[model samples]
Target: MKKDSTMKRVLKLLKPYTGFIILSLIFALGTVISTLMIPVLEGRAVDHIIGKGKVDFSGLLFVLKEIAAVAAVTFFCQLFMNLINNHITYSVAKTLRQRAFERLLRVPVKVIDSESHGDIASRIVTDADSFTDGLLLGFTQLFTGIMTIAGTIIFMIRIRFTIALIVIAATPVSLLIAKFISGRTYRYFTQQSKDRGDLTEYIDERISLEDLVSQLGAGELSKEEFVKKNNKLTDSATKATFYSSLTNPSTRFVNAVIYAVVGVVGAFLAVAGSISVGELTSFLGYAREYARPFNEITGVITEMQNAMACAARIFEIIDQDQVEDCDGEFDGEVKGAVDMEHVDFSYVPEKPLITDLNVKVNPGEKVAIVGPTGAGKTTLINLLMRFYDVNAGSVKVDGRDIRTVSRNALRSRFGMVLQETFLFSGTIRDNLTLGKPDATDEEIIEASKAAHAHEFIRKLPDGYDTVLSPSGTLSQGQKQLLCIARLMLALPPMLILDEATSSIDTRTEMKIQDAFNKMMKGRTTFVVAHRLQTIRDADMILYMENGHVLEQGNHKELLAKNGYYAKLYRSQFMS
Candidate 1:
């Protein structure tokens, strides 16, 4: 589907903030009015002071005092405009951030995993910041600049209509200049935004692996690599900045020409006695005022180019296809029987992972899926969790087709522990209670003991309350233990363990297995393991290869058969 362009979407984002915008317009109006009156007042003072005989200081003084009053009004108006600017800018940025983050949460796991972590993080923060800084200030200046041009045109016409036409005629040239410059430069700004995102991702990746790099003693090598990336970023920025800088000076030149023309033409009319000296002065002032907005607008045009580039990226995320929503309702309580019927699946459709596959397990069965690397072990697990839907056919959990089940409702019945452990930044107790937020302290301890994590957790300074940073705060094995404890606390009707005990010591794995055996009486469990010994006692074992189940039986049956499973088992243990 064709998405709306960035400029159109950004204008749409401004709709909710209209009230703040209207208030800013009010302030802008006041500022422009006060500002335009200055030229008229100064023209009067000039005429009064330069009169033939008497200085007429009294009249000049009155004009000066009015000028002071208008200046004061202008100052207050500008101050209010700035306040309004901040309010609108910050509110818009906040809404964009919230929208981006909420979408981030609901996007498919595959989509989220495909992006660089740093690039995603930068879009939520750095891009939004640029959008706010550029658009807010630009809108503010745009409002005042446009109003100034209109007000000056009216005032100048009152002084002399022909000269006013002259001022208006030259305005389009300034616009033409802007259009030409921006066409050449806008793409560079877009490229610069992309390059900066890459740089952010590179730095973030480096920082995340800082400990490993330090241990490797490759700090200097890392520095040299970073400098190369930094140079690419710098070169792009310099090119973009160079072009945007041209906007102001080019417009200024056109404005200067307009100012000079008004002066010369008005001087000729003054000599012919067609207009008063005071009126001619006002006409010259209007000429300068008329061209000023174009100059300012071109300058803002440069900034808006960058802002529009940022807005485009934000829109790309907003417009991605979201994870499919489940519309089918299943009111029955889950009994944990599962079926994969004639399932066809693939991560990328061209390379099939499973073909016309079918599998069934009764309630409370201990099923182990054993396979070599790239044997579709984890992919099969993903289908059960509804992380990725099938290209053809369906999966039923407790006789309810999972595609019709809301992801939340379907996933709620399963507890999972994968090979890669993840823990949020919080206390160990807090992480344990995540699945069952209402779990009591005693419940936490029970689950931890089941996973054999309680002993080490108690030794920490604050016991279960000990805080953990995002990763590497605890040993990999300890992190894995916490994950198991979390799954135990949830006590879901079904469980999936994907190499869940790979990091644990043999002794610790034995204790956790005992806990699992005790809990497995009436609950269904699916274990994916490469360590054949881990699933030696599974009630039903399926040995798979190249996305097909080649064998199924208990461990002894497979070993006696002396097939592929037997060979893999020997490679790991019998050898």
Candidate 2:
């Protein structure tokens, strides 16, 4: 995106706070006016002191008092301006983060799946902070700097037009220097921001899987990779800082030269009786004041460039294409009868994963999908849940096309338990009641008992109130049981269990299987299992390979046919 367009978008976000901004600008003007009066008052005081005996003590006292009063006003106005600027900067940052998060929630699942989770997080949290810092600089320094520069120019011209023109003529040198350095620094800062996000992503992944790395004896390899990413970030940051740092000194050098020329000319004018000594002193002060804004603004050029880069990244998320949702509403209850007609789907167009798939499941039947890795078992679940729309054909729930229904309405009918379980940082009761927030204590205990998780819960220090995190002490099997208990509490009409009991021991698995059998009695359930024995009672068992359902039947039926299903079953038990 072009820099001007990106900045325009950022300013649009600030439109809501226009009233605060106007008030701050008013305070800034007061600060500049009061500050400009100080130099003039000090010059008058200087005029009162001619010779040791000729000093006008009374006049000096009066001028000093006026300077003191103006200084106090300047301080208060500046304080209020700073307070308002802080409020606006942080508020804008808060709004940006909220919008980014909302956009993340609405974007297509594929968008999230394609990007690094940590990189997305960095754009929201880290990038937003950097942008706000730059914005604060703009509000605090840039606005006031412009006002001060203009005030000083007016004051200087009133004192001596010839020297004032000299100051004005040199303004372009400082601006040109700042512009040249700032332009070169932007690309480096952009690269630095990108590298920082990449490093953050790598670190997040490695830190989350540190245990796995240790177990697999890949610690050294992980460290080497991290070092490479870190070095890349370091290099980019070094180059960006080196270039941006030039703006301040380069502009300051030009301003210093202009100040020297003003001092020499003003001195000659005072000697030639063109201006009073006190007036010459005041003019020099105004010249210094004029140069100060340029120095300060150029000094902040680095932060401004970085802020633009980060803002661009944050807008990338806010501007993503959202998942298309239908406005059609479903009126009646979902009975869990599902059908997929001539379904075709693929992540990539050239590599089709599932094609010409047709399946019909009754309202309360248990269907078991058994397949090798990457055989599209999980894709089937994604389709049923409408996580991804099929390339061709439609999936129907209770004779109504699912694509016509709102996504939330369609998904509310099903419950899922996957092989990888998730437990947030909250109490056990909190995690259990996620699906049904209004569940009573008795209902919670009953569900926990059904999933065989109650016995272990009773032994914990706080039982249902025990806090759990993803890295909590609970074993994988324990977490899976908690997930199952959560589902039991909600008891949706349909269920999808993808290797749901894979982490448990055979004994505990058998107990959970009993609980599952009871739960599956009247609910339409789709089970993806690797253990053939666990799915023996399924009404229909699908043996899938390379996205095709090669054989499907009951235990005795498929065994009798001695086809693909039988061979897989024999290989599992017979081996």
Clashing residue pairs in candidate 1 (N, C-alpha, C atoms within 3 angstroms): none
Candidate 2 residue lDDT tens string, 1-575? 66777889999999999999999999999999998888898789889999879999999999999998999999999999999999999999999999999999989888999998888988999999999999999999898899999999999988888899999998998998899889888788788888988989998998889889999999999989989999999999999999988888888888889989988998999999999889988988888888889988986777888998899989999999988998776777677899989999999999999888889999999999987889889999989988889999889998899999899888878999999998899999999999999999999999999999999999999999998877899999999999999999999999999899988889988888898999998999999999889889999888888877888788889999999888888899998
User: lDDT, candidate 2, residue 76?
Assistant: 100
Best by TM-score: 2
lDDT of 2: 0.91
Error of 2 at 133 (Å): 0.3
lDDT of 2 at 274: 91
lDDT of 2 at 443: 100
Backbone clash tally for model 2?
0
lDDT for 439 in candidate 1 is 98
Provide the TM-score for each candidate, comma-separated. 0.92, 0.98
Off by over 4 Å in 2: none
